[model samples]
Target chain A: MFLLTPVLVALVSILMVWIFKNSDGGTERRKGEARAQAEACPWVDEDLKDCTDVHQVEEDANGWQESEEDVEHIPFSHTRYPEREMVRRSQEYYELLSKRRSVRFISNEQVPMEVIDNVIKAAGTAPSGAHTEPWTFVVVKDPDTKHQIREIIEEEEEINYLKRMGPRWVTDLRKFRTNWIKEYLDTAPVLILVFKQVHGFAANGKKKIHYYNEISVSIACGILLAALQNAGLVTVTTTPLNCGSRLRVLLGRPANEKLLMLLPVGYPSEDATVPDLTRKPLDQIMLFYFLKTS
Target chain B: MFLLTPVLVALVSILMVWIFKNSDGGTERRKGEARAQAEACPWVDEDLKDCTDVHQVEEDANGWQESEEDVEHIPFSHTRYPEREMVRRSQEYYELLSKRRSVRFISNEQVPMEVIDNVIKAAGTAPSGAHTEPWTFVVVKDPDTKHQIREIIEEEEEINYLKRMGPRWVTDLRKFRTNWIKEYLDTAPVLILVFKQVHGFAANGKKKIHYYNEISVSIACGILLAALQNAGLVTVTTTPLNCGSRLRVLLGRPANEKLLMLLPVGYPSEDATVPDLTRKPLDQIMLFYFLKTS
Candidate 1:
């Protein structure tokens, strides 16, 4: 549905190109207006701009055909850090991340919409499998929608905690003491619902399978959390098991889309508290093998 | 398997506490030495250290038992950023990430082992599902292992390109010009095989179910990629769809672990190039609903 507009626009340009190629064209006065419109609407196809100028249509088509013929590549560019700076940055980032906690008590204090936008944009930069970019972010700040989502989650969580989860699972969660109730869902000013698109419809309306949709969405969500943390916002990753369909219905997302996680984004409340948990040390989490030494 | 060591240490400390409580046998000198040793090893439990200090053991146990009485909570801490700095950092990070590309041609230039270590450490900080953190990263630098992995991946990729993937998939991949050949696997100096542990063995040998294992691991992998990129290293995510079992066998990981992705890490070759692709514009990926406006 998202790409349909672009695809339709491209098709219209293709038709325009066909007409310009065959017709005894309009005056230069009309052509100038078309060029101005094309320049203004940057979203329009470049070929359409050339189509308006009949003299350049053939040349543009030739260039397009050539590009279609050979695969193109661009030089990779990156910023290199000095050794000390790299180390310092790594240390600082590690320290910053170490302080991050899975906060549940989120303040209803209003977060600027721009903060949420930038975080989502940062998330969009994540590399996806096959560059499918098969994910969508839905930011819901409406009271009613958040209420609906909270209701759907609590209901499923009730079953999950009471019956679906095994005794060991329940015991494991004893320290966290999380229950069926999810007040934070309605408490946070913004709820970012991450949706994973399993497949997409192509320009030709054919079904295009997305490779590693689960992994791609997870990666994006991870980046989202980090971005939010970097912005000094707080969140906890909450997955409502057995509520995917309910969430889809409420969010008005398509059948192919699945709710990956619901993040309640905001500031930590004045009395907010989290489990005093310690991360596994590097010795436990990592094993290094230097080739020179090994 | 991972937490067993900590649990064992805790058990030994519990025994020591029992002994100290039953008979006040140890002299002040011996007690002082034990307390000093515990202080030296801060990663060892604070409870264990308190146990060594007789006067504090009762108080600590009372605190611990009550924490065990109900769920415990600690204050969440974060560093706040000034407005300008926040904007600048976000823009810089976005720009840095924007330059990141899935480089295929890698130079086997020697990257300091410390760099890889720090990058992985950054990735390890990603929040996990229910705090499970169920992931194991296997860094394979041995030439023989890399060669074996390359072989396994290419074999499956060949089959994938030739048979398994639909025509639409192949057509979609046409622009990337990627085929079954994956020489970068061998050309790169290091390969990190990320494994997702579906469940873990607890200290008591009971099976512990990890929630959203796929999502948790994916998030870590994503952060790993970004961390590597931030460190000026290049990598491409390669998932060998059918070779998880083989990889598990090769890597000596247990049955519970599933190989998620294999990333070949190194500097991009001087002549390396990537497809010039634009990310989907922000408007397409994000929908914002501000409470005040809505």
Candidate 2:
């Protein structure tokens, strides 16, 4: 009986430990499930995942100071126009940009490469965080390569539609009449793939962090869109779901670069149609705090 | 002695449980420390923190489809230019944009509010993900409010430089000659604070997830920058570190909105100087994959 009592004490201790460990394990299991859920959603691309916190402080802290430490400051020349001309220019620019639409049906006719180059140059002028300018513009004009890209994007997008994306997302896109089949990918004469360099190498080959890289790249994209519109070309902005890695590998971009956006640039097809969409009026989108002029 | 054996066994068992719990507690403590470290860094603003994974699928999943379901499709009209005009326009646009610099020195002269209105309107035309158009432009023209903003930003920035930002980051920004004192915030005629709507309410008051809201808003800011340059105004793009929530509250913006970028808009001061930074050449930034015509 005495021996059994000792055995009972030992067993009870083991039971207590198991109970505590099991509770902790439950929390760990829940975290694992959450991560799994995130991975299952293909629209939540790995590329979109924010790793800035991980390397923000560790890598080359500031590219602007590091790169331009030796460069001299120059007087910024002014380009001030008369108030009348300023108003006229701003009004005309607004009118021009307001006419831009995300045209999907791009004609197969070849566009001037010089125009494309100029538009990209305009995009490069966007101000980046710490002036990193962490972007790569890959222009693909090969029909075979374009077809391959389309195939990869379509395959992943099909999975995104059929399984990965929930019913809600599918329902949300119903108005656009968009599907996994991307006809413009095959028909558009040029595909400009924009990549954001997550990090660049310093002169010593150490990693240099690109701060706010995704935002910077997207800003450049906005300028690109405006330039295209100004030149009377048309394109659609697309971030192909779960296709960044595949496209990156296919295009032979370095590990530091991740696909941010894809633009199929060309002229609009004759039968192209757009959903009659109107933007919110200025009052709705803007708020002003002006000193009460007595 | 017989009674003592059972007590001894019980004590030993308790010791085992304590050891196991202590090891688990160590891991939990480490995690807490890591989180605390992240909080200590002021530049790692909560506003810049990515929360898309949390509500991405939960809120209005497909805003494009939901909002535009009833809207009718219309034939798209496009303005096409001849090849020569397209090239000329693209080249001129590039030259105009390339001249744009992040001008920090601003004159106290008031800019025409109408031009500001037109530029914001042009920014509103940028494309958004799922047609969410999730952005708000807060134009602060009241001098008192602008001074208040400068005070808040300077206070936070002082903390960022002295305490939160490590020596490495301070060194990184040394070349820019930027400090906590922001005279432009008070001197510039307009302080355009761009905010991103993380989530919006649908017509039914249900939460609508703004997919890619940050990127969308940044794109708008890019177009806004272009418009400012086209109108011959100069401004510097500033994302005040750790100043989002306070500035948002100061501007009386809603909880759903978070400040993304702040621009001090007006004419450049006479002595305005810029860091003579050159962008990456076109060939360096771009790669082409062209099919060989047999």
Candidate 3:
């Protein structure tokens, strides 16, 4: 086990104090933001003094909770690992991810439905803009349905490879040699079709626009991939352009939902292969700037 | 340790055979995708036929490896946790995310530079659309730059709040009561200005269009936030609309890059507060369909 230097221990203590302090004062009054808002913008003609009153707080009437102001918040405590443990955990996660590949050839091996459910549940925990989890996972397991999707997707891909893509674009794909032929679509035991909700129908039947739907859905997809990889599954991230409307119609989905990705989830085939690509090294991808000391 | 049931062991053995088969046949030829591509379409004349010959594969002159086909692939082994261990890890991660709040009040407390580096490195490990990795993490610590950013963001936010937003938007924000003032921008010790490269510059200065830039960058940002939270740091996802052009200019970034997200990283203030919020339960976000056992 690695030991922390005295200076490093001091820095960690400071961080620990900050973390403890954050979870400590949950019951205390949180008037700082309201007070700052009122003081910072006095240009509003309405008297801003009443804004800081805790009694004026409005609670959600139709929300899941009785009232937003009265919502229960319990204390959160996290396990703090020693320096050696932290290093070990970080290295383990990094190594796990390093081995993950964008698999192209997949087998029709049957995966237990519970494994998929757990990963999707893990995906739901991703944070979204304004807490609007504007994403949905449609787990497709019916073989007939998967075959239909593959047929439709291949038709579009034929056009993409023949007329849609430019010469330069095709040249760039020389490494992977991917020419729109999606055999894995039908071969994989399950296809997770992800949809991004552009708008939701409120209780009043009015359309509510979702903020950052693209960004939020992408984040959820990332977590989903991580969960699947941790569970020892392999998949390829496939995007078939110009098939959104067709997919929505075919799947009998609502008009407000747009298909973002079609992921074929299963084990890699015995002779499966991926383009032996490499990510840019860490130094090229990261820039670290420390506070300058005089 | 929880023992695996005999039934589960059988299932796991099936899965293990599939996994081992994939990494075992290193010398096998991968003609499935290339053959499928050829048979699916007849448009690829003699020119495209040569593209499939393994001997004709182009070696990466500048890359760290030789030809993509000749590149060695090592065995990808994952840690198989006991059922109890799996449940515990999954629950722990979910609980950790549940407690994460979008903090508003930030302290100027100094954070170790190493912590920030590790998280950003974690972010860069996110999988991209086609291994493009078209994202840049610009760590901003200069006070002058932060001040300039604050001034420009506040100006745009003022217009967005008062002039651009509709009445419904303002009503939705009633709980937080957020106005044009963005004190956290300058108050936070570091601002991670994430820029997504819409296109890359080739060695010869030619433009290379990036696929799924928006989706890829968002995934990276999600991993970054998870890493930060795991490290016991707090941050808020802040987006100052219409300030992207000005920000690009101010930061002296290249034209191919666009501002994706502006994250303020620091310790939460002593009196820090967050809006009372709730996430929809798992059933609302996920639909699980098991394969018909018939």
Candidate 4:
């Protein structure tokens, strides 16, 4: 009986290992098969046809000469963890996002640089156009630069809000109690200007074209918002309030790059106040085959 | 020393409790204040204005009836986990999406009904326009309906692909090796007819206004894609290769809604294949700023 026990135990252990290894192998095989099928797909590239006549993206993809040494390789497995805390994580995420307050007024006490950096690092993780990541964040810390930006923004906003450029749409914006006057520009310690570069060069100077540029940038913005909320910081996502051309002239951005958003990031002032706005209901924002996703 | 022990213990414990209570209050206060600030911020409204006409919204808001719930009662948490396994998750997501191959040729082998319903249920949670959600997903499973849809879709697609629309865009689409012949419409067990409601209701037979209809619908699509991926199903996001209005007429959609995307949702054929396109890298898709907001 004692001899039989060891033999039985060995069989069970071997079986367990085999099952685990088999499952892992099965997943990989499935993925590879899926990828193979995807590669054979001819429909997704349906738009690629007339490229022979006008422009093909092949050159843009091939010429990049970014050196591995200079390029930051974000280690893929830096934050591996077990699955037990997903529910807790989801709860915290909801709680933090629920705390997301769009603030305008700023007393501008120094924010912990570490926190700001961490949030940006998170934002950097946002998905982007053509994977071009096609954005440049320029933080204007100087008060003078902030004023310069504010002036430029207000000037363009004034034109948009008052002139023909803004349709009934812009006029309606007036009801929301907003003006071109941005006080946070001067008050906030940092102004992060997000730029979307429409196209860039690989080392061979072949241009890299981005697909769904706006959508990609917008996703990145969403991720950034989530990260900032997680960091216990307050932020106001402010658009240029102006156009890219004017802002480009003001900020001296290259032609390939356009200003996407101007963010004023800081702590809320001690006595800052906000308007009593409300979000649309869940029934309003969510739609399905008439069900909820989460 | 024995006598002193009780007194000291009592004092320290009381102090500890007091500190804990104060910190709790502080947290509550901060949370309340932060949400209030978010609600009242001009920027929040300002951002909304970009998506919805504030004047029309104000008119609605002014006459708005309060919901049974209080402002603080609402929640907007997606998940608590940031998903520490970036590579694993990214790979998972890619695999999930990669599975969304266009199934032009489907076999009516009677797929499980829950697989289809569960996917649609997940899509319903997408955050969108004025929270209007503004989308309708109609699942077509019957063979007759599928055939009719395929016939109708192909009729318009032939015209579109042959030449009747924007040249640059349509021409580009052809390279991907796609034509409007939708065999899967008849073959798959389900066809998702997605509509983007351009306008909203008038609670009292009035045209209720919606802001940023297109943007709202677009976000909903993103959510739908995410939900579908999460559910272990696959779909092709098929923008009409034909005039939306023409397709609408063919599909018998309401006059107010537009044919946005026709999703063919189901499992891939055992031998289905796709183009071997590479997804853009993380750095290429993400950008960072000096300040971050989650």
Candidate 5:
């Protein structure tokens, strides 16, 4: 479903582009009339009759694109492309998504797979650096894979929980009541694995450089969050395993990429609970006048 | 408008609570029923039943509140709140807002004050840590204030543009064709300042630590963007200011707060032009698994 929507949008957008492109057939004629009038009279004439012959002259006598359609393009030579309506629409979609909250302890009911596909597709449209588009999403759905992933995660979590591989910083997570064990990861219907491809494939089997990998990955994740929420699914964004190397080996990830987070996605249980969190006031989070640059 | 909505929700919620509380006054009847049953039960035959003196039992029964209303009190006993249909309906209003964009140039119009108030109120509801909700938004609609801001930014921009702020980094920013010169400061009708409060004022008159300041501020800004856009306004997110101390001194900000970005909000000019920048493709930004944590 996710794949289909982008294709549909792409198809529709392409059609719209063709329609808009063909509509601008009158821009050239106006320019031609202006040029003919200028050539007919080098000086401002006392009589308006100085421009009489120019009205019938060929627009675009200079002949940039000398074709039958050129005659119809003279009036709109100054037309710029319309503003990107799709991008503006995307921003609005994300704004409504801002209301989505993470839910834990989900109910037994299964979330439709189509919903997940649509959400991932929305994430796929996020812009990246150099158009390299070097990201892959591995959706974990089967219970066995989730269990295996949990096992791999738990081994590292045990070490972290035991405080062998961590410092005082580990204790800080307790404020949010996070634990070494992540049960929701196993329980949630899906775990989205976000991987950044460090380089592109080359003919010689070598790697090509990728630019802005971190920023590109982050923006994509941001879009994914928005998409999932937009689709009415809740997600819990779990971050890098503080214990590090354990997760990579357990997840069987290639050396070229690292684990950023295992985002658990599903509906919240009727009894699901969240920390009673409050946000900072609006005044503190937005800047209005001080740092403006045109 | 925002203040009123939450206040009204709370007020109505409290009124419901009062109704529920007042009805609890006669709930003592169930106890009488249980006691009467205990007296009538035949345990050790007559001796057990002997306690059923009619007048005493009647007096005791009258003393206890009736339990017949228990069926009617079913909803009160098990708490369930109203459906958030209105909040969900609010999304449609935001969906219309999805048409707004981040324009580079803005028209100089005298922005109405009421519009600004609604946007700010919309911005205030963003979620935060421990409900700490740590953000502030300062909206500057004054023309003279904008000029002062532009002057200060120009001082920093001139230095950065000249390769004085590290040649390699400055050169990269130039690739985007961005410069320190800020014309939007003067061109926009409104300016919004986003700040994250690292600490909060405690009930004990002391500074309290705030958690997740970055995420908190980012969320609020996201809402602000939506609100402004919903109101048919465009905004540009600018963060060229080094802004730590320089802005603190300039804006009379407290030391605990830091600047994030300056947003110029208004309608786009009829003949505005923007850099022909293209967004990178989506695949490059979203990783299927964690780059480090998966």
Candidate 6:
């Protein structure tokens, strides 16, 4: 009976250890399941998951930059307009931009490459975080490559619409008339794929952090849109859901680059239509703080 | 001593449970410590921590949107430019924008409020994800309020530079000649504080998810910058670290609105200077995919 007691104790210890290990294993298994679900779902928010955060954690002691060399400061020239000219100029610019719309129905007519180059140059003039300029513009004109991109995006979007997205999202989007099918991918004469460099290498080959890279890149995109409008081109801004990795690999972008936006640039087709939408007025969007009653 | 065996068995079981509970508690304690450290650090990356993420997780079953009514589609009328005109317009636009520099030294000369209204109106034309237009432009003209903003920003920035940031970040910013002291915030005639609406209230008072709200607001800021430049104004884009919540509260912005970027808008001082920086060339930043030999 004494021997039996010892054996019982041993068995109980083994059972307790097994239960604890199994419970822990179950938690890990559920995490894996959730990740799998996230991957398959449509709204995969991989927009700003830059490698800088990982490197920052791993190399926390190294700080963010390696360059200690300072640049010289030069006097900034000014172009001050008369108050009346400023008002007139600002008003004219607003009228020009207000006419801009996101046109999805694009004609397959070829556009001047020089115009594209100039607009991109204007976009490059955007102010970046720490002046990193962590952006890449890939202009794809090959018909076959564009077709392949369309296929990949459409396939992923189909899964998103049919299997992942709930009825509410789908219903909300019915107004804009967007769906899994992307005819613009195949129809637009040119596709500008915008990639944000999550991190850049310093001259010494150490990682340089691109601070606020996503916001900087999007700002550049805003300028690109304005330039395109100025040049009389039409495009629809798109952030293809769950297609960044595949498109990155397809475009042969480096590991440091991730897709931020895709603009299919061309002229609008004859039958092109847009949802009749109106923007918030000046009072609704702009707040003048503590104004004097002068 | 007759019940000694049973007592010992019970003691062993109790000890095992205690060990398990203690180990789990250790993990939680470690996590809490890491979070506390993150809160104290200057590079607190609260840029895109929107409430939509939380709502999406909690209300995963309901989907993202609640509106089902559709808007009418209208024919898109576009102005097609001649190839020569397109090239000329694109080139002129690029040249005008390329002259823009992030000028920090601002004169206290008051800008026309009418121009400010026009610039903000132009920014409102930016394309947003799902057409949410989730942005608010707060123009602070009151000198006292601007001074208050300067105080809040400098207080946080002083902490960022002196206590939290490593020497590396300070070194990186040395070339730009930027420090915690922001005289421009008070000197500039206008302070435009850009805020991103993380979420909006639905017509039914339910939470409405503003998809890609950060990117949308950044894009709008981009257009705002361009409009300012077109109006011959000088401003610098500043994303003051760890000062968002305080500035938001100071501006009386709602909880749903998070500060994205702050631009102090006015004419550059006569002796205002800029760092001698150069942007990447077009060939370096742009890629032409598989050009045809025709």
lDDT of each: 0.69, 0.83, 0.65, 0.50, 0.51, 0.84
Better of 3 and 4 by DockQ: 3
Q: Write the per-residue lDDT of candidate 5 for residues B1-294, one digit (tens) a residue.
A: 122345445644665564455344234333543344323221111111101123332334333221121111111111221224323433443333333334666779656555665566555655454445666677777777778878887887786557344343343344344577778889998877766675555554444435445444555565556555545666765654454456556667776666655778777777755434433333443334323335
User: Per-residue lDDT of B164-237 in model 2, one digit per residue for the tens?
Assistant: 76565566566677889999999999999998887677887666657667778988988999999999999999
Candidate 2: which stretches are off by over 4 Å?
A1-33, A36-43, A52-68, A290-294, B1-44, B50-68, B290-294
Sliding window of 10 residues with minimal summed lDDT for model 2 chain A:
A59-68
RMSD of each: 26.8, 3.8, 28.3, 33.2, 35.0, 3.8
Residue-level lDDT tens digits of model 6 in A1-294: 233366666766886786677557645755765565453333545544543555354446554445577799999988889999999999999999999999989999999999999999999999998888999999999999999899999998897778666665677678899998899999999999999998788876677767678889999999999999999999999988778889888888888898989999999999999999999888989997883456
In Å, residue A213's CA in model 5 sits off its true spot by 7.5
Top lDDT prediction, candidate number: 6
- Every candidate's DockQ is 0.16, 0.56, 0.10, 0.02, 0.05, 0.58
TM-score for candidate 6, residues paired by index = 0.90
- Per residue, candidate 3 scores C-alpha lDDT tens digits across B49-158 of 11111211123223212112334444433344555555555566656656666777888976666677777777777877556788888888888788888999899878
Residue A126 in model 5: lDDT = 40
Interface C-alpha RMSD per candidate, 1 decimal: 25.1, 3.3, 27.6, 32.0, 34.3, 3.3
What candidate 6 gets wrong by more than 4 Å, as runs, is: A1-44, A47-65, A291-294, B1-44, B51-65, B291-294
lDDT per residue as tens, model 1, A1-294: 122345445654665564454332323434654555433221222211101122232234232111122357888775678777777666666666667778889989888777777888889998886687988899999988899889988987887778665454566678897899998999999999888886555565544556667678888887787777777888988777768778777777777677777799988888888887767666666653343434
lDDT score of model 3? Answer: 0.65
Residue-wise C-alpha lDDT for candidate 1, range B29-119, written one tens digit per residue:
3466455543322112221110012223223333211112245687766666776666666666666677778899998877777777777
Give a tens-digit lDDT track for model 4, residues A1-294: 122345445654665565555546545755664454322221111111111111232223244232222222221111212233323333333444455556677767766554555445444543332244555666677776678778877886676556523343343343335677888888998777766665556666755444344444544555555455445455676655335666666666677676666678876776655544454443443233322237
Give the range where candidate 4 chain B is weakest over 10 consecutive residues by summed lDDT.
Answer: B40-49
Deviation from native of the Cα of residue B77 in model 1, angstroms: 1.7
lDDT, candidate 4, at A277: 43
Higher-ranked by TM-score: 4 or 6: 6
Q: What are the TM-scores, per candidate, against the unseen true structure?
A: 0.73, 0.90, 0.70, 0.51, 0.55, 0.90
Per TM-score, what order, best first? 6, 2, 1, 3, 5, 4
Q: Per-residue lDDT tens digits of candidate 5, residues A224-249?
A: 56555555666676543442245555
